[model samples]
Target: MQSYWNFPAAAGGTINSINNAGIETFKGNELDSLTREICQNSLDAIKDESKPVVVEFKSFKLQRNQFPQRAELLEAFNKCETTWKGKNPKSEQFIDQAKYILNEQEIPFLRISDFNTKGLEGAQTGELGSPWSSLVREAGSSNKGDSSGGSFGIGKSAPFANSKLRILFYSSQDLSDYQSHIGVANIMSFEKQPGQITLGTGYFTNNENSNAIPGLINLDPGFNREETGTDIFVSAFEPKDMNWVEAIRNSVIYNFFITIWQNKLVVKVDDEVISHENIGSFIAQLDDTNEDYRHVKNYFRLLTSEDSIQIPYPAKSYKKIGKFEEGEATLFIMKGEDLNRRVLMTRKAGMRLFEQNRISGSISFTGILIITGKHMNQVFKKMENPAHTLWEPSRFEEAPKEADTAFKDLRRFVRETVQQTFQAETTDTMDAFGLSDFLPDTTTVDGEGDDKKESLTLKIKSIAQKKKEKPKKKLKKKQRNEEFEDTLADAGIIPEGDQAGHSDEEREEGLGLGGGTGNTHGEQGPSDEGTGGAQEGKGEKEKNKPIDVEKRYVCLQKNEGLYRVNIKPEKKFEKGKLEFKVSGEQSDYILPILDVQSPDIQVISIDKNVVRFINLTGKKLKNIKVKVDYEQYCVMEVDLYEI
Candidate 1:
């Protein structure tokens, strides 16, 4: 039995001196988290498509005499304690637990086994790049592919974190050759002893030599059959003052709810089996039906079936990034439940990028978004952190250029689509959104029609009180034209035939978005608002240049009636002077406004043609009318567009 105790060591510091932070990752809601972590590993290890993975949890009480080399093991345990004490004479917590597990003849253990999949197959030791090496021998050695759910192999440390004695045994059978392997390891605090350094992690096997093999079990005799899989035995797993069974079962059903729904994994605890057969019953155990659970279910429905939670409006778009084999991404959004609003981002492989409490809102201001791309790996690979808990491009500055683009494009698309969908659903009247003015096939926002992309800026304003707008007199064509001309003049836009013009120095100073001079588009800038300004050139050339079909800006209003939406560019604002500039050339744009019909507010006239922003600039500010009686809310979406 002493020969079976083949411990694996860590580098830089002994395993005894292992950092608690690494182990702390597995310390949340013990049983629930442990079940999720372990199940994820088993799922990732699946080798045969024809067979479903099977996991079993069993606990047993054994007598001291059950050990094959009890005396030799006791001697080794004594030596381990002596060495541990020499390293850390001050700390007794780890040593005390070790003494209990080794000195006690009647110790209990918990065993979890996975069947019908590739077991931990590969070299037992000395080489890298194997599941055995990553899972049992190395910390943070994750050889999992892109599709694998476990981001870092650190998840394997979960079992040790849950064990009272921090001791675990591994026994696996290679499915291909039906060969057996076994090993034992212990996770302990870092301690140093002269010439007696203990890594705390060790392997156990029946091999006559020192090398630890993965297959030979010291006690269980029935695991060597041809069927392949791995089994983990945990020693002294009784936690203080908690019902481990119930907690473990609930956590399994909660965290793996989606996996269980797919019918790929089954978990058993003693005589009680938890699988698809009882998934619903387990879900019933939750108090609020859990938003995360609902999110997963809704996503599955959208993924497998076309049926989705419907929205009354039609301001949504479907887009794709990269031409990966995983297929294009389709985006559909609508008004959803007031709470738990989220963007359900999922991979084709069915792993959702779950960031809890990600989106926040309330009542009329709240919205839900669902985003799915079959070839999501191309985008997500660049967005994930080592923990795989959050996804953001800013998280990866050193990533490849294409990956960064995918991240930016995907984020923009999701943001624009959700804002449009929310405002569309919330508005009561189609006239408010000017929906009747545009053809059904016309693009409601930029990027709806062509591949040309625009960097978009988002600003959402929610009014707390319901303000009534009195019907206003409609402006004549001449008055509207004058207002547009005045706005351009404020931004230093000279008319095509007008003689008066700003000096060349003034023109250069105003040749960018928000009126600052320089090349802005597609270049690194001092700010995030990529230059929305046009190029400065010869006066005649600048005036005669065709409207860059790609430079259009679009705003979506709930109703055709214009509500004051003030969009302030982040840069170059001095005093009250506005510097944002848009080219003064004719272009095409759509302003779809949805205004919910309210009996208290009178109806007003609406614009019925394409609106251009060539005359619009940051200098013009629209004042919002407020009623003393109610809080007025205005939500507007601004996107750079090319017509």
Candidate 2:
């Protein structure tokens, strides 16, 4: 007998040729999309089980030629299963069939019970439909589920994108029967056409496959279990283009986990459990413990559908929730569906859902909803309709009357809550940082406080206003002058032009003087002829015989003081001569002759005992005597005074 097999004509071509011929296309944000998809699937699986779920990660590397591995296969299965989980049968049945086919190929898989996989059963035949039948059935009922974040059904192709490898997966779901379980094991191989991959299956055992594993193959001698749970094994997974640690951390931060009620969602990276911290708690702790973490908190709520609303519920009494070893206090209130949930060490309220008629329930820790980078852009695009008013109406007059009324009340309530919280926290922090002195201290009043509080606030405001309005006084000029003078005095100098003299007494003494005398002497007069006795005797003879004018002469008496003398003789007498004689009290007078013609004369030369006279001023004198030895003449003094 001869056997014949048919294959594609291009099957023998090189991987590069197959890749370039449109047989593979990998241009997608597949890694990011797949990570999210896988996380969602794990969450759903745990949610379905209604038990604690622990996802353990282990380090494994897939090389280029190692075409298939267990991790990659499990990742692919998760994507396909989650994509068709809640969809209608017609549209998603193909993917469902693919999963079933892959399960049938992975046979003789291991079952474990160490974690939560207790009470599980192995695969049983006659449970799932034929591979072809399941494919058709799944195709008829394909519709996307609510919890899936990715739009494209190609998320399953992500882990296989960059390599030629094969992956195997072993996973199980809890069965209703305590001793029975539904489980699957599968393999996926990457082809040259980038993200496009071929899937095959191994054995699965189940009491019945209720459209659970569409193309699953049944293994003989199914194993029985005492406890029930699922297990996943991933083999050849290509590392994502981006950093894996960052990708996993971000997915954990943003994706919804509110529906995880009974199960604890655990994620591990390379066999290490990633520590999950609530965003609010983390922020609060950072602020309280780290001085640098102090910053403003911006609160926002994002809602997708129009029917979603934020209803205001009445404020409840606050109660202290937790106390730190450092004496820091945390407070909270009992409200909303998650009222029993322990509020974190920080006092911020978590997200809460309120029912109609202002009743609250269903709280969520929405502090984790941080929109960043691409996610932020997506939100902006999605919220473009009516373009969030930021607490304002488009047209105030056109707003519905009922909505307006409710909005005003709600606004007041929200504002009050925010103000109160801000004040309380600010006070607490100021005390902690030793900055309380920088802020004003004011007593906070309760909701029922009176208008007097408003009055006190107004008074404080008035005081501040008055301070601002008061006028400043200008400096006086006199004071400035005095200050300048004082400075000059310190430097040691009298001011300009203040000298000592020019007093009143000096002027008064110089005003009293009059005027007085002048005197001159000396002239020669006629001499009397015939002296007394001779005259008497002669009188007898010729008593009156005329004395010859030229022959007889008598000396004239000299003036009492030193004098200048002048003499005149009668013109008719031909030899008349005038003689002047010096007399000493009627004794004989001796006359010494001196020069009568020279103008320059020395009256007496005392040492030689000589006397001479010279004419001065061109005047000639006939009878003048110069004496050299007379004591009175030699001692004479001449006095000339200002007349």
Candidate 3:
């Protein structure tokens, strides 16, 4: 069959945008997206239970004639060069690769093959919701089911971005048709120029066949005729990052470990093979210093029963349901190495939201919280943004109001769990609010015991005012007012001169500062004003002054020589930066060092025995950790609070 290169409608500037779209989907790490995207597609292609899915990545040198549709592909390459110069003004590699693919006898190519899977199969109608339609003919149309990992169908851009020639060949054996289909597409930025134009995204296929669409062929020498699978060949493949091969391997093993462990998939990179049997050894290649490695390793070990840790649902009482009864949470904690503090949270599918790290406080322990039940799935799913990185309830405010309530309950549950796990009895201030006193009957009443029966019941009552009769001794208006004033003067109802006629009861209720009356009862006291001052005297002038404005902190001695420092930001400073100095008084301790807990706060330096830092976080309050070091092998706790 005579082959011809068919190009799609070259919309003005549309190809430019599409060329950049795939690259933008994976901005930071190209290899991460590459591994994730290709692997996801392979998993979705799995249609056989008896045979395992095997994906292979291989590099080989192939002669130009070996390619089945070399003539049409060369035509496509020649056409790609017409506008390549204008598109990539400085990229000589583009011209070199294009010329090499067309003129050279031999070229290097990357072949990524997936075995024992249903290859891209569907009627080639250029229609939506078809694997063949989307993979070969469409750009962003998706045919993925709900359980599929990819949704946008833009993941193919990763491989295209990695290809030096911006051309990739798709060869797959449709199990139902029992026929192999070979196609090639070059997605790149192109300058629109008359009849020579093509939407950088087009197919290289048979031209003689009347039923043929763009970018399709019937055969290829590289196609595995004995097996049903797909092979994606990248002509002139080269990665910008030098260490991409190793990095991609590690990423693949780390990300697909769950699939590997279940014996569902196997990956081969060049000569080395990665499968469930040897997945652990492959994972060891990842940087051990990274918290990600530790998390994955520990998680895998936990699943395989290799680690010594026990995590159970929190005692039933710890799980609280809000008024909606929509969600409940349980915390599982363990004592392990003080690495990264993370709380692994999962939804109904058991896929954890990795970016959402709920752990607070120091990295002294590990915790895992499984918050699920009732309407939580609807709430969490609705809350998940496109990235699936967070459960931001605010993003879903337009959703049902119930979802907002459920989201709030989830947050409260997380906060309370974190406090219970980390802070312990440090919540005395919250307990001081006397909130429990307002709650309904918590304890059962005993009818037998008289004391238990005499529980307190608060009641609200209305009091009536009494009418007073006219005084027997009548006098003029001035005399009557004077008489009332004399009576009030004796009773100390009003202030007299600077002495401030405050009764003993009023004095007791005043500022409570030494002997002075704090504030009169049923009157506007200094405490009632917006400021900290009273309505009378100096208190009135100083009204609106904040209470507890002094800077105060509490230091808790953790170990014998270590202490945790907490600064009260709300009570002292609210805006701008704050500076504090900590000096060691002990003669034995020289050059005392303080280790900062949070990256948001910067620690300037430590000179001699003093440690200084400025609060970089503008938040109203923060808990800053200042670790005081003593002489080597010495046992003593430096008093930071006293200093």
Q: List, residue by residue over 1-643, the lDDT tens digit for candidate 3.
A: 6555555554444554233666666756776777767877887788786656888877776677775566766565555567665556543355556667656777667778898888777634434567877776666766765445555567777777666666777766667744445455655544434644555655556652212333323233453545667778877666667665676788777667767776777888777788989988776666778767877675555446533343333322112322323234444444345433445555433334552232343323445454454344444555665444466556555554555455544445554555465565445444446666765443435455445443568786977888996644421222222223233334453223213332222222211111121111111112222212123552224222222211212223434333333232223322222222232333232325556564545554443344434545553334445555533222222211101
For lDDT, the strongest prediction is 3
- Residue runs of model 1 more than 4 Å from their true location after superposition: 7-15, 18-21, 67-77, 83-91, 123-127, 187-196, 206-210, 214-226, 289-306, 309-339, 348-353, 356-375, 378-383, 392-405, 418-643
TM-score of each: 0.58, 0.28, 0.58
What lDDT score is found at residue 336 in candidate 1?
40
lDDT of 2: 0.28
Model 2 lDDT at residue 274: 38
Candidate 1 lDDT tens digits, 1-643: 3345544334555445434555677665567656767777787788765655788877776576764345544555565565557566533566566666766877777788888768777745435678777776677778876656666566777788777656677777765544555555454433233444456655566543334453456444433345677878777777553677776776676556556666778888777787777777666555555555555444433434443433322222223333543224555443444323445554433344453221223212222232333345535644676544556666544555555556445555554555565665556544446645543433534458566443446687875877887744421222222233334335444231212232222221222111221111221111113322223451221111111111111122213332322222222222221112223334322223333222222223111211223322332332221111112222222222221
Q: Residues 484-567, candidate 2: write the lDDT tens digits.
A: 222332333212111122111111111100000001111222222411112233223221211111111111212222222221
User: Candidate 3: which stretches are off by over 4 Å?
Assistant: 10-19, 48-52, 80-93, 123-126, 174-177, 189-196, 207-225, 241-245, 306-334, 344-353, 367-643
lDDT of each: 0.48, 0.28, 0.51
Q: RMSD in angstroms, all models?
A: 18.0, 53.8, 18.9
